[model samples]
Target: MRTTETSSWMKQLTSSSRQGRHGHALHLFFTRLCLQPSIHGLVDPYPAAVPTALRACAHLANAASGRLIHALVLTRPALASDEVVATALLDMYAKCGIISSARKVFEEMHVRDLVVWNALLAGYARHGLPEHALVLAVKMRGLGLNPDRVTWNAAVSGFAMAGNDRMASDLVCAMQDDGFQPDVVTWTSLVSGSVLNFRYGRARMLFRQMVAGRAHVMPSSATVSSILPAFAGVSDIKHGKEVHGYAVVAGVEQEVTVSSALVDMYAKSGLVHEALRLFDKMSERSTVTWNSMIFGLANSGHCPEAVSLFDRMLREGVKPDHLTFTALLTACSYGGMVEIGKTLYRAMREECGIEPRLEHYACMVHLLGRAGKLDEAHDFIKAMPVEPDCFVWGALLGACRSHGNVELAELAASHVRTIEPSNAASYLLLSGALASAGKQNEVFKIKRSVKRRRVKRLDGCSWLETS
Candidate 1:
C-alpha cells in the first residue's frame, strides 16, 4: 500500500528542499497537505511527499513541524507501515537533535531494513555518541546485518567530529579490514575533524595525503572547504592559494560551500581584494559568504565598503544573520560611525528579531568607547539585560586607558580582575592609564602589585598609552 512513485506535489517539495528554500517547503507541507486539507476534503498526499517534507524539516531543524508530519504519517496506515516513511521520520528527529524521539520511531517500526539500522546508528554517532554507534554496529552484525560503507563512514564522522583522531583512525583501519575502501568522505571527515578541534597541522597533512593520492581519493568540494579553514586559521595564504587552484582543477571551485570557504580564507589572510573579487563573481552566496566579505572589509579598514556590501545584501533580499550584524557593527566601530552603529543595533532587534548576544553587546561597548562617549558606554553596560562579561568591561578599560581617565580606568580594571583574576591585560592597561595621567607613583604601585602576585602576562597582552 506504500506509494512508491514521485507525484507532482512530491516533486515540488523535493525541488524546494534541494534548492535550499526550506521555509517554502515547510510552508507547503504544513498549510496545504500536512496540517490542513484541501477544500475538496480530507486529502491524502502522496506517500513520498511525507519523506520529502520530513527532509525539509531536517534541513530547517524544525522538530515541531516534523512531529506534526509524524502525526499525519501515523493516521495513514500505509505510510505508518512503510519502511521509507519510518526511516525518514527517524532521520528528521535525529537531524533536529531529538535522538530519543528518533529511537522511539525506530523501535516502533514493524520492519527494519539496513537503511533503518544505518539511520539509527548515524543518529547516535553524529550526535556525539560514537561509542553508542559502535555498540549499535556490533548489535546489527549480531542480528546478521552487515555494516556497509555508509555505516562505517557514519562511525568515522562521529569520532572525527568529536576530535578523537586516534579513535577515528582506528575506525578507518577497521573499516578497511572489513574490505570497505575508504573514499573521499572518509578523508574529508578526518580533515574536517582535525580542523574543528584545532589540529591544523594534521588537517594540512591529511589534505596533502589526499593530493598525493595516498588513498586514491580526489579532493571533493567538501574536502576543499574543510581544509581551507585550517590554512585560513594559520594565515597560510600560500597553501590557501594552492587549495584555491586545486578547487579549480577539481571543478568544484564554483560550489557554494567551497567558494564561501575561499572567500573566508582570503579575507582572514588579509587579501580583502582577492576575496571581494571572488565574492563578486559568485552567482550564489550564502550567509557565510557575505559575512566573510563584510568582516574582511571591516578588518582591512574599508569600513564604508563593508556597510555598502551589507546594504546590497539586504537589497538583494538575502537575509542577514547575527554574524552579518557583527561585521557591520565592527565596521561602524572601526570607522567611528556611532550613529549608524546604534541605528543598526536597534534594527537588528526590532526588524530582524535576532536577540542581541554577548558579542553584539561587546561590539556596542567598543563602538561607544572608541567614539569617546565614555559616560554613554558606562550607561550602556549598566543597562545590559545580561551580566557584563570581561570583554565588555575590557573594552571600556582600553578606552579609559586611551583617554587617560584614571578613575574610570580603575573601575574598569577592578571589574576585569574580578571576572578573570589571571588576566594581566587589565593591570597593564591601568598602569598605562596612570602613566598617561602623569601619575608615575601610581603606575609604580600597580607594577609592583603585578610583580608581587606573580601574574605572568600572556603573550601579546601589551597596552599602548595614547594620552
Candidate 2:
C-alpha cells in the first residue's frame, strides 16, 4: 500500500536516526511524512517511522512531539502492540522525565524483552529512584531473567548513586560470583561512585586494583578521567603524573575529558605551570576544558594569568559560561581589580546573556568585601534579586574580621548562624572578630555557645609531598 517515494523517505529517515543524527531536520521530515496524504487518503506511517520519531523526541527531550507520536501509535493498533515501538515509547517517556507514563507503557506491553527491562531499569536509575531500580532487578531475577552486563552495571551504579558504596561494592562482588567479571564500565562506576560519596581514598585504591586485576580490559578515557578527581582531592601529584603517563601511552591524552582532568589535577595539586603547559598542548578543547584551566589559574593565585587566559578564550571565539565568569570574577577579587570585577558582573547579563548564579554573587561579595567595601557589600546583599546564602554572609564576616569591624561582623555572623546554625566556620570567624576587637566577653560567650552546641571544629590538614 506504500508508495515508492514514501518508502524511500522512511528508509532515509530511519538511517539518519540510527546514525544518531536525530536533530531538527529529522523531526521536520518525520512530521511532514506523517501529515502527507497519500493515494488512499490518510497514509499511516510505517511502523519503523514511529520508533525513529520517538528516538528524535528522546534525543531532543521534546515531550510534546512524543505525545503526538504516541497519539498516532494509539490510532494504529499494530504499531501500539509492536514491541520495538512500545519500547521506544517507554524510553521516550523515561528520558523526558515522565517515569509514570513509561511505567504505564511497560505494564501494558504484550511482551517484554531484556532490552525493555534494561531500559526501564536505567530510567529508574537515571531519575534517582535507585531503590525502585533495585526492587525491579529483584523482580527480574524472580522471573528467571538473568541480568546481563548492562543490568549489573545499572544496579551497581544505582546503589553507588544512592551513596551506599558499601552495598555497591558488595553487589560488584556478587556480580563476579555470578560469573560476570567486572569490566572497565563496572570499575568506572565504582570509582566515580566512591568519589561522589567522598571516599576519595577508596577510589584511589580501586583505581589501583582495577589496573592490576584487569590486564585484558584496559581502562578507558572515562575510567582515567574518573580517577583524576581522587588524585586532585588529596593533591597526589605522584599518582596523578603516573595516570597522565598512562593516558599518554594509551593514546587517550587527546580526549577532552582526560586532558581536562589532567589539567585540573595538576592545577589543584599546586602545579600551575604544569597545568598551563598541558592546557597549551591540548589540540582540542571543550567548554569544560577552558573552565578548568581558568579556575585552576584563579585558585592558584595566578590572577593576571587567569584574566589573560579569559581574554584569549574570548579571542578564540569560545563562548564564556557562568563558570568562566566566576573564575574571572574570582581572579579580580584576589588581584584587587574591583573596577574590572564590577564591569564583568554587569557584562554577565548584558553581554554574555548569563544570569548571575549564587556562586557568582558569592564571588562578587568576596570581591567587594576583600577590597574593604564593607558597607557597599552589605547594601549589595540587601539589593540581590535572590536571597543571599550563608556563603555570602560568611564572606562579609571574613572581611569584617580582616578590617576589625565588630558591629558588621556580628550582623554577618548572626545571618550565618541563622542559615547554618551548627556551622563551625561561623563560630570561629565570629570568635576571631570579637577577639581581635578586644571584646573578651563576647569571645568567651561564643566559645561557650560552641561548646553548648557541641560543634567540633574540623581539623586543618594539608597534603605534603616528600622528595
Candidate 3:
C-alpha cells in the first residue's frame, strides 16, 4: 500500500544515487531518505535502497555512516536477507578500510558466494595482508568454492605486492591449467608487478606475449600504459613505436594515461621530437600530461622548450605541482639559467603556495654548484629549512672537483661520508678531486678507505633489443 508520492520520492532517491554524483552528495541524499517522515513516522527504507546507501558510505570511506546503515538493515529482515545488500555491505566495509568488520559481515552472511569471497580476498590484498589473502584463498578452495578470474587476479596481485614474482608467474600458469584464460587485468597485474620488482626484462617479455594475443584477449589501455616503462628502461625505441602504432590502431592514443606513457617513453628513449609531436596532438591534457612533456623536454636537453611549456601551462590555467617546479628548475640548472631558476624558486612559494621540498632544494644546490658558485651553494645548504641530504653535499663536492678547490671538496666529502658511510660515490668523487689537484697523499688515503670499507660500486648497464 505505497502512496504515489512516497513511491516517486523513493524512485528519485534511487535514481539520484545511481547517477554517479560525488560520494558526499550521495551520502547526504541517503541521510535525507533516512530522515523523511512517512505516514507511520520515519519509515524503513526499501531493501533496494540498502545497496545504494552502502555504496555511498564506501565512496566516502565513512565507517560511521556504514554502521548506521548496518543497523537499519538489521531491523528489516527482507533487506537483511538480500544477498546483494549483504555483498554491498561487505564491499563497503572492506573499501572503507575496515577489513575486520568486512570479515565479520562475511562470516555472518547466510548465503556466501564467490563474489563475497573475492571481496574479502581483495580486502586483504588491498590492506597489505597478502599472506592472509593467500591463506584465505586456500581455505576458500577447501570449502569447494571455485576461484574465478577476479579471484585469481586478486591472488596474483597479492603475490605481486608481496614481491613474490616467481609465485605470481606460477599462479598464472596454474590459472591457465585450470582452464581459465588470463585477461588484460591478469597480464597488467603481472606486468606491473615485474616492473615494481625491477625485473624489467621479464615485464617486456610478458608485454610481448600479451600483444601476441597469447590468451586470446586484446591488450587494454592499462596494459599498454604498464608496458611503456619496460621500453623506456631498455631505450627500445623500435618496440615503443610498435606499441605506439598499436595504440593508434586501437584508438586509445587520446587516453590520458596511454598518451602520458607514450610521451615518457619517447623522451626517455632520446626521441624528444616524437614525444613533443604526441603531446601537441593530445586534445585534452591532465597535470601529469603537462609534467611528462615538460620533464621529457628538459631531460632531453631542450631546456628552453621546457621553460616555455611551463609558461604555457600557466597561461592555460593548469596548476603546476611540485614535480613541475622540480623539472623546470632542473632545466634552468642544466642550461645555466641561474637567474630564472632563482626567480622560479621564489615564485613557487609566493605565487603557487607550494612549500619547497627536498627535491627542489637538491635541484637548486646542484644548479648553483654546477655554475661554480661554491660559496653560494654552501650558503644555500646552510640556509635550507630542512636538513641537506647527501645529494646536496655530493653536488658541492663535484663542483669543488670541477673548480679545483681541494679544501671545500674535503669538507663536502666529509659531510657526505657522514650521511652515507657506505656510499662509494662520495669516496670516488673525493679521490677524483684530490687527484685533479695533484694531492697524491689524499687520493691514496681515499683509495685505502675504499679498500678498507669493502664498498662495492654499483655497475651501470644498458639494454638494447635487436630484431
Best by lDDT: 1
Write candidate 1's Cα lDDT for 1-467 as tens digits. Answer: 12333355566777898888988988877665545444445457677678888888888899998998898777777888888888999999988889999999999988888888888898888889989999999999999989999999999999999999999999999999999988999999999999999998899989888778557688889999999998874347787899999899888999999999999998987889889889989999999899999999999899999999999999999999999999999999999999999999999999999999989999999999999999999999999999999999999999999887889999999999999988899999999999999999999998899999989887763233233
Residue 37 error, candidate 1, Å: 4.7
lDDT by residue (tens digit), candidate 3, 1-52:
2578657756766676667553644555566565766545535776666787
TM-score of each: 0.91, 0.87, 0.81
Tens digits of per-residue lDDT, candidate 2, 241-359, equal 89899999999988889999998888887788998899999998878888888888888898888889988998999999999999899999999999989998999999999999989
RMSD of each: 4.4, 3.4, 4.6
| Rank by lDDT (best first) | 1, 2, 3
Task: Please tell me which predicted candidate would have the highest TM-score against the true structure.
Answer: 1
User: Clash pairs of candidate 3?
Assistant: none
Clashes of 3: 0
Clashing pairs in 2: none
Model 2, CA-based lDDT:
0.87
Model 1 bad stretches (over 4 Å): 1-7, 14-22, 34-43, 233-235, 440-456, 460-467
- What TM-score would candidate 1 get against the native? 0.91
Arrange candidates by TM-score, descending: 1, 2, 3
Better structure of 1 and 3 per TM-score: 1
Off by over 4 Å in 2: 1-82, 95-97, 214-216, 315-317, 465-467
lDDT winner between 1 and 2, please give it. 1
**Prediction 1 global C-alpha lDDT:** 0.89
lDDT of each: 0.89, 0.87, 0.85
